[model samples]
Target chain A: MSRSLEPLLTSRYGIEESWKLANAERAGAYEVARQALTTRKPEELREEVKKANIRGRGGAGFPAGVKWGFLNRQDGEQIYLVINADESEPGTFKDRSIMDLDPHRLVEGAIISCFAIDAHVAYIYVRGELAFSVARLEQAIADARQAGYLGERPFGIDHAIEVYVHSGAGAYICGEETALLNSLEGRRGEPRLKPPFPAVKGAFGMPTIVNNVETIASVPDIVQMGGDAWSALGQLPGDGGVRIYGVSGHVKNPGLFEAPVGITMRELIDDYAGGMLGDRPLKAVIPGGSSTPVLDPRRKVDAPNEDHPLHKWHGQSEIDVPMGVDTYRALGTMLGTCCAIVMDDTVNMVEACRNLMRFYKHESCGQCTPCREGTGWLVDVLDNLCNGRGKPDDVDLLVNISNNMMGNTICAFADGTAMPMLGMVQKFREEFMDAAIHGLPDGVRHDDSVRSMVEGVA
Target chain B: MAFALTPEREQQVDDILTRYPERRAALLPVLWLCQRQNGWISPEVVEYVAERLELSTAIVKGVVTFYTMFFDEPVGENVVWVCRTLSCDLRGGKAIQDHLEKKLGCTAGHTSPDGKFTLLKAECLAACGQAPMVQINDYYYENLNVAQLDRIIDAHAAQGGEDAAAEFSTCATFGAPHGSRGGSVTSAPPPPSREAVRLASQPPPANDEKGEGS
Candidate 1:
């Protein structure tokens, strides 16, 4: 279904000068922040956001209002709102567009969110490699400051805001909330232990609110339009606002598709992305980012057949399940980042898994032994199996190792790495077995995808 | 060689410090500013940064090594990142890597002989939708082919470009994803099944059958 009214996050993506301050202001950029800052109470703004059911777009989809409530709310301690622009999750490119095409939207939302949480300052810790995005966002921030949209006392309001943008030195883990805080603090970007969550003690031991790029960029809309209107955009009650989905890999017309959170994968592929690249039969789909499990959409995704207790907790099937956090959780996976990667039959599952494993193995912080060691072991075993010299038990052996690694590390990084392996070993076990017992799966030829380069030319 | 930031850059570093309540917070940005000037974060630069932030050199070194962006050694005049991840892999990222390695006379993470280019195989730069994408300094050359990429690089080399990262924007440099010539052609699809594949799908061979001797 087409989105009613204007697209909240990407309303101006296609327009010329959408990123410039003049165009954004002409299109009503900071009006909500202006009104909210001067006319509305901070708590009222938070309530409106709470009513809108806005959730974190940084993968977890944690309700943003609930997260804002976690701020100590006391008068003395300083509160900080960190924008997670470190969009490193594989297959997820939705946030980059906002940073590139519409930086003012984020600036407006960050200002409104700072008011809601009573945070005087906000830091956007951008990914180091995203120098292009950083440059655009920095220019946007400068323009906003020059216009008095930022800095101490805006438009005669008593409230003050100072915006600063920081760059992350390339670490995937920095996308994690605690790890992001650690990196922002000029330390190693390692995930911190929970219990003293970031809401209570974060970013130099202050009560901080960390949000994803899309999550904060979505705030101004809920404020501009009433909360009920925003929530109605969701596929389900309490489903929050629309999500920015990235459809990539093996799919024709692959790009950003904005829709309600619970839109099914089938619709995303066929209707939005123009189906598979050559209309080939699908092998599998990563419903979310690399951290989430893969879905073998060709078969039933019943709960009882799943390899974890996730189904027992929520109890549902995922074959045609709506793509949302709770629905995915019920299906023994997560709706993280909403970066969908569709695989065609020609792909060798073993090599795909290896490509994914190498990411985790390289990204692990070594803060926990299980993650540091377990990831390396998985890579080694996959190398052996995919490169010849694997025992048949290797697939099952991997399953066993992944099971041990899940929930046993300091952070969810271990589980995030393990879940995909679990998905590959469980759903695409035959392919893994083929690599071990025989060789690459039939029809999967020439390990190097160099043929892609030639085909694009010839 | 002196491991010092220029007066204006030092002011930029000091300004970044005011954003955070602590002095240590400026370490990363300071190091980045240094890299922007020096092309790499050398040992003396690292020590200079450590001194500036009041952090131990070991601590600064640890911080530098932890993040991938801060280079320990000099890079080429331009750094090109060819994505090497699942979506890119499926879209032939490996070929782009091989092509760049061949053209630049350097493998991934190596500078070219003329020091004009440094090629790196990066992990998921978050442009999956534009499969087979490369970030050259600041601008993205997405949905690329060997021919199109060759032209882009040749144009840049002919211009004798410096790092455009600080001033680059998508609206300016993203000329077009692919060049005029070429279609996505493929060899005939592999026949659906094979004899060995069919045999392996049968109930797993009893563990005892293939073991014991080994």
Candidate 2:
């Protein structure tokens, strides 16, 4: 609920028919884009973004301006800009909101991004499940083109641009920049090994800058507000811009919440989402999406549990931190995608971990050995733990498998799965122990004969 | 080959191919068209897509196999994706899946006996706020409980694929909203998006003046 001078992404979220282009323009949608293209040089525009220090909202938190700087301007290749609309991360639905509610914001943002990078064409690889959002975005593109916001020297830019929305066939790995490039090129959605990173070689061997939808969507606002002005909004030096945190799970008013950097996870849940649903005591929260390490803020921030291996590895105690890239990284977790998932008293952490792992196991592109095999192994062990067939060392073994998988894949996918998996096993070892022999912890309602494998049951 | 794009669909495929510099880049869209027309993408459809896109069938097959949404085998008339991710599961996604399984008389990834529905537990449809939702064919039924889902199933179970669409029905609203010039493309380059045709049959509004008398 708390935000800066004005709401950015969610400013027109709830307004009826805000997705329409005319309404969006009436609400000040394309002005910034027009200003950027007409007034500012491409380098100036990029500098404004760079000065803002706005990190990628798509989980990586890589600075957008720096990413644009990677474009090989002198390469003489047709530069490409790909909007990673494949927002397949579990619990992350913020991109879809911008696409469904204020698609012009995204299109304008894409236009500005393309202009900044000097790219002629951009593609939005929409998630297959987001049929409505895609339809809405495609229509937005057509509208923009019809209105001359895109194509053939519109807005007084010398270069014309075309934006297209392509449907992703449904794979979470496709959300990865490299994997997305492969998918975009009509290949299997597997991570292309880096070193020939997308900036150097991407989308049919062209200089490419693939950015998250939210990241690009913020460009228009940054250009209008100026970089220094925008950066000044953040609580920290590098932290600026309003991040649309998609709060899901046990929160009372689960929806997209746009707040500036350094917004504490507590404020996001307690104030914005109206706290835990049904007035239940808080248990834990996935600080940023399901992939980020789950934090147990509900537990008192007591002395370090040295006995816990993760506590020993990270050398951190039971803690409290704000929701930001640096803070999460301090906890050995990433503020991935700004998808905050809340868990309250009634839930079981072991089962929750299993649910998360199920997504990872299913989404692994399978080109990498560690993620393909290790994730399924993690799921099976968690399944055994839930079904009362686990050992005391099973949690430790889970941690071991996670450690082995980290940094050993074509993508950070193994680490994404492993880091969070390690967090669950290390932080909630007791819950796994309880679930192993004694069944689910007290207070959870479940059938005695049911199993906990992600895929076994209907 | 068991199937081929009709001359109209072939033109549509060519239109999609023109969007990309390379023909192969239209792979996914062409496959979507194939799946839409023929309930699932079979080997023949894959080959047909390969021929249209100028890619090898091996490449096409690899792409299809990687994505979970591409059904290689035949599916029922309607496919139900019940989200069983963390948010939805916490907010009764499992119970919704269970309810759907019982109603459809099949487990996840299985087709019903009557060949009308296939219930599958999807990872997340990204409608976490509207937890425990399902996407039947293209229309998303969100904020669902067992009863709400049951009513939807009853309304949709008997309908064929052609009879169902992502019910934007009003041409004016659908086209007017996104600036699509009333849902169909005014440009001669690519054909109207599949959505234009699929959504054209949207039922008239309930309270509209035309619906009352006409």
Candidate 3:
């Protein structure tokens, strides 16, 4: 298949002067918002989004339209649409690019999303560390409001939409929807229990829809072109639109690429990314953000597609995965946040896990006892293996901790932290054991191994 | 000398307090202010923050301990926050840390013997493309290789560099505030002076129920 237009979704981002809300408005940024206000009913808009088949960009491939459909049409309580801008999922930085390059895109998308959902209040809960993006977004919102695109009586409509930008205080758990709501409500960033997912009872105890930056930003396309047209934008079956994926590590062009969903990994690396940098050979790829299970470049992903629900969910086994949303799911992982972290041959998988452990352990909110302790334990085992002090069954122990931590916590953050650990242990068990045998390679400094081991394993 | 929260600072603290519906929910910002004043969250400052925010000492401690941004232990005169996120990590952040450790005779999490510098490996500071960066005090030195970092450290340690060091002393001095959240330091009021604090302490307006009435 011939490649489509190269810029894709990033076409607007190139024009620096066009980044302003006014320019964007003039260029049809708020056209959808106006359309939602004047032309379509809120329920009709939601239905249209459902037809678009847009999926959540934050790791999970949940249908965006379906997620939005879950929001009850009753408008008694104030509805909220929170933009989860906490893009700290290790390899994920596409959201950052969106917010930084043309925040008005997000503002436009958000306004349209709010209109579609009948939410009068929208909050952009930016990660604590994203100062530039926050400023950019705040400015975009102010500009949008000045142009009557946001705020009370926006887009010449009877309904008013108020936009607020709130900052998270540096915690990864806040990336989780409910956890983000809790943080916005002035609490520590920890995930709230499900059964009352954000759709049911979210920010300030009102029904809310929490969406990733890209997911929300994708709304305008669906609103403008109609859902059917937008649904045909990507590569995956029933996928929608080009994704701005951040591909790093060993890639020649270690940066962001806006590509269709069904694009193959080889195309992403070899064609878009210019292949691996230097002479390093491809070893593995974390197709999504850190949350997805790592896939060995050599091994095929065997995901079976039987008619049974159990088989459909679990029997999905090894296949040569591509970069699309469906392909990622087929590989027992989701095209999460699209933070394609590529690992080359030179990288010691054991050391990489150690690096990842430090992140997981540091970012764990410590809300659940299992996640709080489990991440520490997994990190310790990985640390020992890296420091050449691994025990025989450390591999088994890592898996055990990871297995126990999955789906047992208040939020998916626990599972996010566990997935990488699973990837490390499952895909590179021998590397870890070998490191334990050989010890810290010559110059590798082993600091606090005893401390990390005692604390991590115990 | 132990610095106390000036009335203006206290008002700022109170404003943060009122933003939260729960009176005691403002512990993080209050402790942050206290740490800024006292150069660390000492036992006394934590107590003061706890009292001010209507939170217990342990509760305040828990918040401080949970966040890596809040330093529980005292750091040196200058804190070097190194970004260790994926982009920076790929861009040789580990190598830079090693070099800094060798040059400063301290690892990523330790302070120098002379109480001059404390190196802390931090999460993403959002300057990913410019990897191997360090926020020395308030100023960020980005795109730092070993050579660039050496020049930075050397510039600080050079003779008659105290003035320069003071000018470049904090991450806030970099013009743009660096964080995933604080909306940059531009939004933050400049560090309060002692006299400003004293003047802020005198209560005047009665409509202070809006949290931090000065």
The sequence of per-residue lDDT tens digits that candidate 3 reaches over residues A255-324 is 5666666666666666655566554678777777767777776664443556532243242223234465
Best model per lDDT:
1
Question: Could you report the DockQ of all the candidates, in the order they appear?
Answer: 0.24, 0.19, 0.07
TM-scores of the candidates are 0.90, 0.88, 0.79
Q: CA lDDT, every prediction?
A: 0.77, 0.74, 0.66
Give candidate 1 regions above 4 Å deviation: A1-5, A73-75, A301-319, A442-454, B162-214
Q: Which ten residues in a row have the lowest lDDT in candidate 3 chain A?
A: A449-458
Each model's backbone clash number: 0, 3, 30
What is the per-residue lDDT of model 3 for residues B77-159, given as tens digits with 9 covering 90 to 100?
Answer: 77777767655565566666777788888988899887777888877664443333676654555545465567677776563
Q: Which segments of candidate 2 are over 4 A away from where they belong?
A: A1-3, A298-320, A442-458, B158-214
Say what the RMSD of model 1 is.
8.9
For candidate 2, lDDT tens digit of each residue in A353-454?
888888888888788788889999998988888777888888788989999999998898998999888888777778887887686755454431112221
Ranking by lDDT: 1, 2, 3
Clashing pairs in model 2, backbone N/Cα/C closer than 3 A: A59-A337, A289-A339, B169-B202
